[model samples]
Target chain A: MIASAYAVPSVLVFVTSALLILIGALGVISVRNPVHAALCLIMTLFGVAVAFVAQSADFLAAVQIIVYAGAIVVLFLFVIMFLGVDQRAHIHFEPLVGQRAFAGVGVAITVAGLIALMARSHWVTGAVSVSSKLSNGSGNVKELGTAVFTTYLFAFEATSALLVIAVVGAVLLARRERSTTSEEAPQ
Target chain B: MNVPAAWYLVLAALLFGIGAFGLLTRRSALIMFMCIELMLNAVNLTFVTFARTLSDISGQAIVFFVMVVAAAEVTVGLGIVVSVFRRRSSTSVDELSEMKG
Candidate 1:
């Protein structure tokens, strides 16, 4: 009786997020233009952020939007513009012989396997129900901060290191000049 | 009130499959990269769903790291893509098949 406040809104949020995610995913794959696909990817990222919010992981939702949509996708677009790779790619061509056929088979197998596994396992069952771990009577961001800095401190530090290395590597890779024009010629 | 958690899980699975299909079928380096991002997002959905179902906070925390790793991957990957495009002036995997020996 009293839970409807939570239930009804959650149901609405869930439906909206799900639809947006599916549509965006399809658009990303089916859209011919790279720019359009990037936009679709943004939609999908936003949809996922909504789903996170619905689940009460408010911190994650925010981070998802900031990091993924704001930074990552923007980086993708920057690279696309810089490389001029936004020109239409050979979407129809299968680089490897019979790869499309193989991909089709792989998709079927993966879908069937996932469905069967989920049906057989109790992992999805309502075991513990939703808890306030994210908020923990304080605030969403605070709980996340405590968990990350205290319990997952090592992992948090490791991520910082990894990010540093990745940034350096990206800069180095992007800065290197093509050695020889003749070497650039396709064999 | 009982939106079965399985529904979310199933949605994640479907999203993953779609992402995989895109990854396999698409040849554009950028589009393929976008497809990979789709797959990662699907995994994040699954994590959040389980975090809710199991009443655990670790899943969400893990999702944070996943986002971090994904950001790093995009940075490095796009750099490589840019380099390759500069060298060969093409992003098509078939056209960039220089190591097909």
Candidate 2:
């Protein structure tokens, strides 16, 4: 069993990640600027990655940081900047007009339903058996790699194919057609 | 103090609700994207909490796939935003109403 020294850091990591997540979620809604919203999203993504690490999913954490915070968000910022869209030119916020009431009622009913279901379910107190497969194995890159290649080979291949389709579709959609209007055409 | 998994689930639920509110109220495409990211992160938190409680690695594996799909989505979403901006010179969701089929 790991000592308290190891456990303390993990606890600290979880607390900080949860705090950051809440802060980021608030920032996402409160900020009016689009760039600032995207930056808040980056913070949220980083917090989530830390949470993953604390859960002993080191490989998943790395993937979260690299794929989400590193690549996807940067791409978003680049496109926002490239488009040169004015942040404040046409600001508009529609009046709630009964929608808020409807939303509140919907949320209340959903919460009531969830509470009733929780009251009825016995799974919360049921005996949980730790699977033998992961008993001794550390959730490191090595274990993940072996599992992905052997047990999850089909799923991995499917993901690759989906990625390929995404790339092709993005390329086709991103192509900008040149205007052929006779404004000194070919001059 | 040791926090229980239920606390994390409650936090995730709150974040999800906030994201949904933003999605409903916001008119900016970029803001909407941020809200979508919030929702995704909320789901990710739920995944992590379950993974911790069950002591299983499968939930983390699902999170890995979710992150991949999110990346692909952002790429495509930003591309569409750029194209919309090029045509209309704005990123407001209301302005795109004319382009609706």
Candidate 3:
């Protein structure tokens, strides 16, 4: 990388995003109201977008806002309103004994292991610009678009099929009446 | 121009850990779904970090696919949630453990 530390502005950006992410994540879990949780989720997504911009992923940042905050969270809110499950859950009820304790322990261990692994890896050759130099500014969108169209063309096309399948499957699953045997037999 | 990749990596790790905790501890299916999205974002952040570090555009491309897949997954997953809610008026995972043979 350039150095052990970056510009003060960059560091501030990182700190701000990190705060947004952690606080929003905590809010998502601890908040009893599902609707509030969804709002908090938007905060987390925006935070990730900020981090994306900090890393020069301006295109992804835009997609993050447009797709995630724009579409997905709205879908979540729609489902919550449609089902009327928007009320607060009973967070104090421990139906499963010691579940939170065990989960906390496991997640802590996993995070520590991941951090240690990253530290020991030989990724010290960081930012060598091996493939395409990610020159910031106007080049980001062009670079990402070219990669999606050229190298990942097949996968990109496959996603269209996947989206269609998901749509069909969602309709089938959420239909008001289940025919059981055949769709044509139903009134 | 940017921070060290390691900083981003560590941040993502913490994000993943938080998501994992929420997924495990939260019994509400909707909240669990949100946690899964949280974890997915963490991984996407990592991909973007590497995309910058290696100066490889492919990492960003993969993130694009991941986003598409995530959207599709949520669509189907929420449909299943709606159907399940239709059968039982509650959204808690504790009530859906009937298949534990």
Identify the leading candidate in terms of TM-score. 3
- Docking model 2 quality class: acceptable
TM-score of chain A of 2: 0.74
Q: What TM-score fits each model? A: 0.87, 0.82, 0.92
lDDT values for all models: 0.82, 0.70, 0.89
Docking class of 1: medium
TM match of model 1 to true structure: 0.87
Candidate 1 achieves a global lDDT of 0.82
lDDT digits (tens) for residues A13-103 of candidate 1: 8888889899999999988888888999999999999888877788888898899899988988887777764655656766589887898
RMSD of each: 4.7, 4.4, 3.0
lDDT of 1 at A52: 82
Which residue pairs in candidate 1 have backbone atoms (N, alpha carbon, C) closer than 3 angstroms, thus clashing?
A: none
Highest lDDT: which candidate?
3
Candidate 3 chain A: 10-residue stretch with minimal lDDT: A122-131
> In model 3, which runs have C-alpha deviations exceeding 4 angstroms?
A1-5, A86-88, A122-131, A137-139, A178-187
Where is the poorest 10-residue window by lDDT in model 1 chain A? A130-139
Arrange candidates by TM-score, descending: 3, 1, 2
| lDDT by residue for model 1 (B24-74), tens | 988888889999999999999999888776776778778899999999999
TM-score of 3: 0.92
Clashing pairs in 3: none
